[model samples]
Target: MTQPSPNTNQLFKILATGQFGTFLTEDGDNKYVLSMSDGGYEAFTPEELERVCPYTIQIDFMAGGGAHFKVPKDHGLEEGDSVIIGRNFGIVKKLDTRRDNAQTAENLRLIVTQPISTQSPQVVA
Candidate 1:
């Protein structure tokens, strides 16, 4: 097995931020959803981190499964905006909703990427 590149790991960062979230949209081609929390990003306990930034993104699979990233409320991101994660880059968009109140029924922003390679998962030891 080989080590995962920093760029390849970037997508995991976005997915790991969710305290709790459900797939707003999922298909054979792609998946889009919001990951946020009133408690905070990755903050398991209330006072775990002094600076908690709850964020969200919309990813596809082009740059490793992400095309557009969307965030409810102005979490310092807007539509048509682009961001850099590690060595990879992605675009951003703002949803006309609040993070706490965001839902599939409401319009959501999403980061689109490309179809992930249909390869078997690899494990490194």
Candidate 2:
């Protein structure tokens, strides 16, 4: 069967319940969300070196299946917006919402500013 072509306003669905342990935004700013799963999936963390930089931090991000959506070409999203992905909830911190290459039709870069804490799960309902 053929898959449907993605729409600009469509949700960038992550079918696989995989995990991305540590990932940075297109820029230096980072938005780390707790991994929300049913105890079945693949999780990975980025390898790091011991180095120091101004305003740098060491974060052990427990990111789960992202509540992800693609940024439209017209650019409808912005930084500081709130995102609630299942058991994860945070505000958008950094936005690398740009299309520098023609290879891709849209940009999917997002960085949340708020840190994950012991709080209620955010359901986008």
Candidate 3:
């Protein structure tokens, strides 16, 4: 079977404080595959990783249940891409397919690459 390309219609958001890599501003047209995950309201892309910054996931995606905003197989995303949302980063771990009630499905799993939070422990005096 063949795969489709990315569509600009579908979008996701992220939350960030200081600079956090290359992100699309609200004023610009949607052309990214990865962006803020805390209400970014825009698509994102990782063609450039130099545009890094501090960020935090808008939703609890690294937990047991799973994230709220997820891009199914139809999203046209592939592996080798590291997604940076807020201060969290996950790589397109792998592309796998599962059957759902006889329906063939493909899903992308982003493996968190940030390891741990960059924030330092607070020094309470």
Candidate 4:
């Protein structure tokens, strides 16, 4: 699918702070079993990565379930772009069916992307 231009109003951002963590769910399990930790800012692209500040983030999964995840200024991110989080840490496999539209209430639907799935990540050229 064709991606909206960078100037399009469909573009949105997700800002996250604090230590980030991820856990893998066992087959047929709804919860993540494995856990990992990371620091500093991660972006969709190298350009976006450059805009982040390097700092140590404290992530505690045992206390809480969710980790800090963000969608940085992804001007270059397209529908098929592989949004790699922390090197090859994770890759964006596909964007959810939801679209971003700042002008309407329907736009409030949070855009979800499957990055850690088994599918290979796609990056638009």
Candidate 1 regions with alpha-carbon error over 4 angstroms: 1-55, 59-64, 67-73, 93-125
Judging by TM-score, tell me the better candidate of 3 and 4: 3
Error of 1 at 72 (Å): 8.5
Candidate 3 segments exceeding 4 Å error: 1-69, 97-125
Considering TM-score, where higher is better, how would the candidates rank from best to worst? Answer: 1, 3, 2, 4
Predicted structure 3: lDDT: 0.38
Q: Against the unseen true structure, what C-alpha lDDT does each candidate score?
A: 0.37, 0.32, 0.38, 0.28
lDDT of 3 by residue, 1-125 (tens): 42233333323332343434234342344345445444444343333222322221222323222232334436555655545445454544444422121221123344444568789999999
Candidate 2 Cα outliers beyond 4 Å, as residue runs? 1-70, 97-125
Write down the TM-score for model 4: 0.17
List all candidate RMSDs to the true structure. Answer: 21.1, 22.0, 18.1, 23.8
lDDT of 2: 0.32
Q: Compute each candidate's TM-score over C-alphas.
A: 0.25, 0.22, 0.22, 0.17
- Across 17-84, the per-residue lDDT of candidate 1 in tens digits comes to 43443223223333332233343223122222122223444532337655333344445555565556
True-vs-predicted CA distance for residue 13, candidate 4, Å: 16
